[model samples]
Target: MAISSAGYEGTVDEPQWSDLLANGGGRQYAVADAASWKVTAGTADREVRIAVGRGYGYGVRDVSDTVVSLTLPAPSSGSRYDLIVAHRDWQANVTTFTRIAGSSARSIPTRVQTPGTIDDQPIALVRVTAGQTQVTEIVDLRVVNGSLAFDELVLQYLNRLGTKVRIGVTEWDRDVDSVGNPVWNRTDVTPDTGWVEATRNGGWAFQYCQFRRVGAVIFYRIAAERTQGWGAGDNLAIIPAGFAPDVATYVASSSSRGQGREFVFQTNGSVDTAIASSGATNVTLIGSYVAPR
Candidate 1:
């Protein structure tokens, strides 16, 4: 085997199954943190389902969901068991669902004490009462994917839910790149894109107006007054590179002493303001909007 000095795949330094998985109460990632690739109740009583998700299970990336009806042997008086995983393992080339039996009390059941193969990735707990026909309850034991050493949100490993959640985000735009593959857009250091002042237009005077970019969002502050007639599409400022939103974003303000004004972010990176024809003075807005990449 070639020794990989750069932690690349197809070598000894390839990412492990635990790399994309997180723990429920385990601290491999953090102290008493979260779980990854979570499982939930299915349509049927005996069936539990895991939404289509992705993870490295055998040092290989696997994308799948679990919808199989688990075996339910009649409990003598009821047995308490922890569902160790969706852990893709065993010589049979299957995801082994090991039930570690323990206390029968109706509460958060105990998980495996020293689970590791890179530590145990538990999905949930299962308790079946004697003569029960279905799984009593499925406690949500999953948390943000923290199998890695960094924070999940900071690392951007999310997207482990929904149908075909391999690299797709339903609510987030620009998640997929030009080739449609999911990508992490953050850098090790967030650039300090400074703000720029807005230019006066159509007799409108700028008191304070500027915008800055931090990560994938753009924040701006505005304060201005109308000294003269301000038109509908007057440009205020130019949005910095990579900070303009896919769609136009807006901020509005109006005062009885001044006039109603709206700050519109144009796709061309120009910030425009539309003053109300029948309203009064000073407009001020302080907010942030997404700059999707």
Candidate 2:
């Protein structure tokens, strides 16, 4: 509980400086979980498109890659799950991604990363059928989360937005109206769910933002000017704990042209969406999610 600034004058004794990443690769206290390193199906079935991405691994600002193609090994005599992962290896002093070949079984194995600096960001799962050269099923496993030095994003929401939230008088599990109307069976939760107006990476100025949570339902309408680092598929706001959905919650929001834009709320409180153009930095987020407790 000492009062000290983060990396003042690029000093090593100060707290890990997350805000000064570009300045001689400042320290990264949190493993960045953003979409900078996105992986998708490449031009060929055996190839994967790895977009240039940036990440922080083990107190060091890791890699940011340009789009490249990675060809995986051919399938063997038995079906197995080959995971495509992006990680920074401190032992080799390199930040890159590779294919981890699972055993001839079904279970997904853990990463064999260096224990000292293990930053494994799973990109996708390539299921290989026995005796096949080209892949058929490429499951997108990249989670559109973000980085936080010492959970600064968490502290921002806690210190700035902790107030009396609106609570539902009587939350419910089952609701029925007419004799033969639709009956709803919902999970039970109280005021334990809430959301904060959050942004990506570091600094971002907000405007006209409001968020609320009642029981298992959370609503948010926020807009912010992007003034700091941003990555593809990063979350804008993080939903509080105890209300994470079993699956990702999707909400279709109206675009400026009245078109629909999809937003996903993940189990780790990451509110995700498609990558916006670099020129379009002013972002407006509005949606609601019903948590499946």
Candidate 3:
């Protein structure tokens, strides 16, 4: 029978042909059967649904019975399918099918068709080999150029058994040393002590400190304000615990005035001695210390 709509020209079953002319409707037919129909002329758009059975619906052939081969429509830019169902027997073991207009066809399973493992959770894409498909949870996934923004980050280094090293930023204060010599002692500034310690020479204001350890090498940055002034042979600051310099050497050019005004990490203890400079000014000490683990 001939199917005729307002502008459709095609052949269909007598029942469908009559319905098309009487109600100006579209039709759904099996893909295999649609191959025989042709649209000669039609200005009005009509939809002809094509069904390719793959055991998902009632009475459809079981996906394991025969592999189903389908030629998918050319993909559009930025288009993605949330679900794709297929068979493994009809054509071969191949399941899903995808094709872009200008790219090679991809047969791998690229989407989830139903809720898997966890209730109502969709499974990610997976590769299926021969035989019936089996579902498994995806453990690891990687994305290129992906960014994760976080308010804070905690980094921990662990040994074979447990955590070994932990690094983080903490507030410290400058306190008077036990020897009564004006020394910068790293103290917990919880009560907001202002981190400033007034010594006989000048006042040392502790700004902040960053500490990190890589293997046996420890790196530190200590920033402080030098008020009043300092003279030669003054122990300005003390290295934090677990970070005493291994050798007795001076960090030259550590001051704005340069060379002669330097700092030395005493080999005997964690004390940092500042070689007398011309005047007292704000200073930042940044250096690496070799400490045994």
Candidate 4:
């Protein structure tokens, strides 16, 4: 067999079973990773397979009956990648997978650890692709015993790398007589109408959060107040003004000044208010970490 050193950059939307049948080849590579294909109506057309280069081997750390752990060395720092662990049983699903350095999971289609009955299934590990000086992401995925059978594991690297973004925030209580809904016309800040801006990044990400829908919804907790707008014996209930015409529950009346307070929405409560708004009022929000919601 001749050797070529080019990269494949096309999208692969085929099922694993069909690819396996078409290629019928898996013994020439130095590294290997399993790929799970979906089956529908007995036709396995599209497949999702892992492209592992030669000479790469599993860097296994330790393994238990239902749990296996390993160390993943990245090509560069700040790169996004994913590690998929396949279980034999569909019932045996991923229980939990936490990054060592507090990188929270952005989204998950299925539970990390779920029970399955399918044999030779594959899970995925996806992280943003980037170049950095230090490795900031380490993760562990554990499956529940007796939930599913065991199979091969797959690691997939995502295209986008995780870029660092800094943020800051400030909280204040406003009179709920009216003017609670901020406008969404553009990125420019509006007067009196709530608006937000990115402190950096050439105004890359900016979002404004507002409380709209009434009915058992907590807008925000007033931690401090320079003006007695939210001080002792204040009757301000954080009433929902603009979009929220209905009356909502507001936790007011703190015993002392500079005390700890929090707002929570009850279970099954409605938050029919927009977290953002715009108008012709001028207000300056002094804070950092202005992210787009």
Q: Which numbered prediction scores highest in lDDT against the true structure?
A: 2
Task: Write the residue-wise lDDT of candidate 4 on 13-60 in tens digits.
Answer: 345333332332321111121211111111121112222221110111
TM-score per candidate, in order? 0.35, 0.39, 0.29, 0.20
Residues 1-293 of candidate 3 have per-residue lDDT tens digits of 11111121233457544433433222111111212111111122211111232111111111122222222232333322221222222222222322212222222223322211111111112221222122111111111011111111111100112211112222222234576544332222122212222222225666654555554565666556566555656665655455556677676534563334566767654435466556656556677766532
- Candidate 4: worst 10 consecutive residues by lDDT? 55-64
CA-lDDT, candidates in order? 0.48, 0.51, 0.33, 0.25
Question: CA shift at 155, candidate 2, in angstroms?
Answer: 23
Best candidate, TM-score: 2
- Rank candidates, TM-score, best first: 2, 1, 3, 4
True-vs-predicted CA distance for residue 33, candidate 4, Å: 26
Query: Runs in model 4 with CA error above 4 Å?
Result: 1-78, 87-135, 138-248, 251-293
Residues 133-185 of candidate 2: C-alpha lDDT, one tens digit per residue: 56666655533322211211122111111111111233222234577453433
User: Candidate 2 at residue 60, lDDT?
Assistant: 49
